[model samples]
Every structure is written in structure tokens, then in C-alpha cells.
Target: MDLLMKSLKIGVNEKLYIKDPESSTLGKNIVEQSILMIDEMGFDNFTFKKLGVKINSNESSIYRYFENKHKLLLYLATWYWGWVEYRMVFATNGISDPVKKLEKAVEILTQNVEEDSSISHVNEVVLNRLVINEYSKSYLVKEVNQENKDGYFVVYKRLVNRLSEMIAAVDGKYPYPISLASNVMEGALHQYFLKENFPTLTNCNDSITPTEFFTNLIFRTLNQNIHG
Candidate 1:
């Protein structure tokens, strides 16, 4: 499901009614605009007043949708993960073969990185910082818990599990491990993105698109590790 559809389902399950289409759109707009602002200003420097001006909506209107700036950030993060999940689902749909499915998953994720550079950059900077801050300080722990319960992690866990199943399908004796695959996938992409785009980092002319690099790397690594 797309982020909006997922959000609507959650709202319905929670007995909340959108009631007003304009209000619903406005709230979503606020969250999206807030993320963009957080991207440009960094989370620490972003403020409700600044977001208000950017969205052309008053602070009171924003507060009506979100209790506070922290809540807004949480919602934005949730929406982001929702969008990622949506893309993954779309990319994996109609693929039945395990190996093909796994390849497609890698392709989708890598292509997503290049397809939406702005959102990808925002996710790298703002959402990652928030996750790290929460992990380090243990603040917002409860909010993170709530977000997970709302199916954000559920979708990712399912994806990983499916990938693991595919690996097992390919090689009967293979040690199918979702966590290991996930770590490898994320680590490779993080290195690529940081080196290519992050300021103050050494630039490497890797020149390879994420899809090409990941497709070859993942297939080769899996084949060597599991089949060799």
C-alpha cells in the first residue's frame, strides 16, 4: 500500500475519521513540507514556525494534526518508511522465482536511491540522524515502538524474510540469513551514497549505478558464500 493508503487504514482502524479531504491533504502536505525543511535546515535547526511559513499554514493548524514538532518528525519518518515499503512491494509484485525476486528487490532499492534524489538525501541526513539520536539517548523510544507497531517494520521484515526464503530456494544447503543479507545490502549502499554525495568525504569515481553494482555484488556474494 502507498503511504497515504496505509495512513488511512491506520486511521480507520484507530476509529479516526478524516472527515475533511482538504484537512487530510493539508496534514499530509505539512508532514512532507516539514521533511523537506528538515532536509534543507537539518533537524536541529528546523522549527515549527519555519515549517509554518514554508507550508503557508499556521503553527496552530500544524499542531491540530500533530501534537508537537517531535510528533511531526515521527510522522514524517513513518511516512518515509511507508513510501519505501510501497516501492518495494510494487517492485516485487508478479515475481515468483526466488532468485529473480531477490534480484528485483535489490534492483528496486538501488534504483529508488537514484529515482528520488531529494527524498533520498533527506532520508540519509534527517531520518538517519533522528534514528541515531533516539538510539543513543533512548529518548523517543516509546514513539519508535509505536511506529514499529504501526507496520513500518512489518513490511521490511517481510521483505527480508522473503529474500531469505529465495536464498534457501536457490541452494538447499545454504545458510539463509536475512539479517546478514540486509546488513550487506545496507552497508554497500551506505558506502556508495556517502562517498558519492556526502560533503567532506573522499570522492571515488565508482561511476557504476547502484543497481548495477548491487546486482552483481549481491548475486556474486551469495553464490560464493552459499554455493561455493
Candidate 2:
């Protein structure tokens, strides 16, 4: 898996950046430090100027890679989804049972993220936190319609579609596969947020994880037995 990830280059939309952050050392530093800064400070307070200071470069240098902080956030979010899709494919590669495959997929999506040692520059752990906390901001904007038309969110959409297909495979008669798949993905993040900030609102504590809840919900919704 390490070798596979190292060899793999998670592609972001070319339109999302002025330059590809993965193409150069300085560009890579911009991406790496931005993830750390955004996770530490929160995306609303994060800025390219702050990131440039952290990376020891001028603010203009950061702009050479990304047009603005919003674009940078979109880049990070898109990259994270691409990485997730890779993990999903790798995890369920040989599983013949669709139920088991869908269960594993849910586990991958809802479980807390751990750092991947294969990718040294980007911290998957911190990036995951950023996604959980700030992913909605990336698209909840006035330009969202234009951005969507430009394919800035293809990676995320693809991940959802993959999960949707898995749900369909498991239960061919399930009418709301896509709707349920999307809800699982979005609900996991919301549940994590609730677990962190509003503990009283969510049952996902140290023992009761979002994974277990979603797994149970999926099987029950499809009228399938997990142990079957």
C-alpha cells in the first residue's frame, strides 16, 4: 500500500490552482503547511499570508500555486477525497460478497483517519480533521455553481458514486442507493463534529463510533442481515 500510494499522484482539478502544488518543492510546501495551519487555526481564520509566513515564503509565492485560500481549501478537499477513493478500492479489491464489501467501505469512510506514512509531505491525519471541520466551506459559496460546472468537485462526487454503486450491488432492489450513500458520507462528518463539539447530540463516543451506526443503518435500510 505504501508503494502504491507513493507511486500514485492524487490528481486535483487543474482549474483549482494557478499551478500544481505537487509539481515542485515550494508548491508542495505550500500544500503541506496550509493543511497544518488550517487544521490548527480553522479555515475561516486561515490565510495565504499566514501560510506563507509559516512556510517562510512571501504571500505572493503561495498565490503562484493557488489563486486564493478558497481554491486552496478546494484543492485540499479534492485531494483528500481522491486519497479516500484509493483506500476504498484497495480495501475492497478482492471481496466477493457485496455486503461485506459495503461494510468495509462504510468502515473506511467513517473511521477516524490515521496518518499514512507513505505520503511524507501531506499529513493525512490533519487533513482529515480539516475535511471534517471545513469541507462544507469549500462548496458553500456563491461560486459553487460555476465551480461545479468546471468539475472542481469531481473527486468527491466520484467517491459518493462509488459508495452508491456499492449500496446498489448489495441490494439491487434498494431504491435510494445514491441518497443513502451520500447521507452516510455527509452524516459521518456531521456526527464527528457533533461528537467533538455537541456530545449530547450524537451517540458516537469513544465506544459508539460513527462506523457502527452507519453500518447498522445501511443494512437495516436495505432490509439485509449483516450476519447473512
Candidate 3:
């Protein structure tokens, strides 16, 4: 009877055992496999079965960590944000000048897009379709609304504000509005990405890359603001 009670106590504390090295490694493996599958099949097409096969585990094992596909995608999205934040922090580290900061920020953005082409493509497709096709779906609508309420756009706004303050610091008499310039810069990047990836509608040649276009346009915008 004492042995039985001890066993029950151990069972109850099994989650505490999750700190064990083997269990931690298994957990990392699951997330790593999920990311691999997402990069290969994209978020929409990724399935528990696929991840299970990839990790040599089963659907039940994945469900132990993630509640469902939506939860898994959320995890992936959060992971992507972590990656972006890491890059942004490293890229902007030690840069105090506002104009230099803005330039570095734009450079980081372009480099991130370039480095994570597959993930970026998947995100673009999902976000674009969500805005158009799935807005009426409750989950989709809620996700989109939540993103607008608390995600990248907020970060972007803060970055813009920083850039504006930097611009103000540089020149007291500068006429170009920072907020407007930030919007234009973001718009230019979006348009450049779309045109580079979907040139048929954009009516532009495929010779130019998004990075190239973004670099040129960003410098041109800054130049115009300073000169014109």
C-alpha cells in the first residue's frame, strides 16, 4: 500500500519530471520538427500526422504540447516574431542616431525578408488571404483583429515614432513629415515585395529584387526629404 501511494505521488509529479534532460530534449525536438514541417509544407498544409512522421512521434504526442492546429500555428507565429525581434535587436544594437537607426532598421527588415524567404512567403499568403477570403470566419477575423490590436503594426508605429524623433533631432527646420515618410517607406516595401513576387499584375520586370528596390527607394525617399 505504501508503494502504491508512492507511485501515485510520482505520477502526480511527472510534469515536474519534465525538467529531466531527456524530456526537455524531446520537447525541443517536437518544436523543431514542427518548424521544419511549417517551412516545407506551410502553416495551412501542415498537419499533426506530418509532424508526427517527421518527429517519429504520434498525433497524441503533439496534442500533449499544442491544443490544436490553430494553437500550433500560433506557436509558429510567435516563434517567427521571436526570430524577428532577435534580428532587430542585434541589427540596431549600439545605433543611437535616429537617421542611422532608421536606415539600420530598414536594412534589417530587408535582410530578414531575404533570409527567411520561405517563411515570409507563407506569411504573406496567409495574411493576404485572411484579409480577403477569411474575414467573415470567426477565428480568422479574431486573429486578424488581434494582430492589428497588439502585434507588428504596434511595433512598427513605435519604430516610426523613434525615426521621427531622430529626424527632428537631426534638423530643426526639415520639412518632410516623419510619419508620412514612414508610411511611404512601408508602402514602398510592400509594393516592392508584391511586384517582385507577382510581377504580372505589377507590370514590372523580374530583374530587380525586393531588397534592391527597397534600398534604392529608401535612400531616395530620405534624399528627397532632405533635399526636396
Scored by lDDT, the top model is: 2
Candidate 1 lDDT by residue in tens digits, 1-228: 334433332211121112221247776576566656765676778787888888888877776665566555554444444455566667778888878887777665554342233432233345443432332222235665765666435544555665566566666565656765576445554645555467345332356555676677667767897757
- The candidates, ranked best first by lDDT, are 2, 1, 3
Clashing pairs in 1: none
Candidate 3 Cα RMSD (Å): 11.8
Residue 128 in candidate 1, Cα distance off native in Å: 12
C-alpha RMSD values across all candidates:
6.0, 2.1, 11.8
Taking all chains together, each candidate's TM-score versus the true structure is: 0.66, 0.96, 0.56
Compare candidates 1 and 2 on TM-score and give the better one. 2
Off by over 4 Å in 1: 1-23, 112-152, 197-206
lDDT of 2 by residue, 68-187 (tens): 899999999999999899999999999999989999999998888976645867889889999999999999999999999999999888889999999999887778889999999999
User: After aligning candidate 2 to the native by TM-score, how far in Å is the CA of 210 from where it should be?
Assistant: 0.4
What's the C-alpha lDDT at position 63 in model 1?
65
- Quote the positional error of residue 102 for candidate 3 in Å: 2.1
- Count of clashes, each model: 0, 0, 0
Which scores higher on TM-score, 1 or 3?
1
- The reply for model 2, stretches above 4 Å from the true place, is 224-228
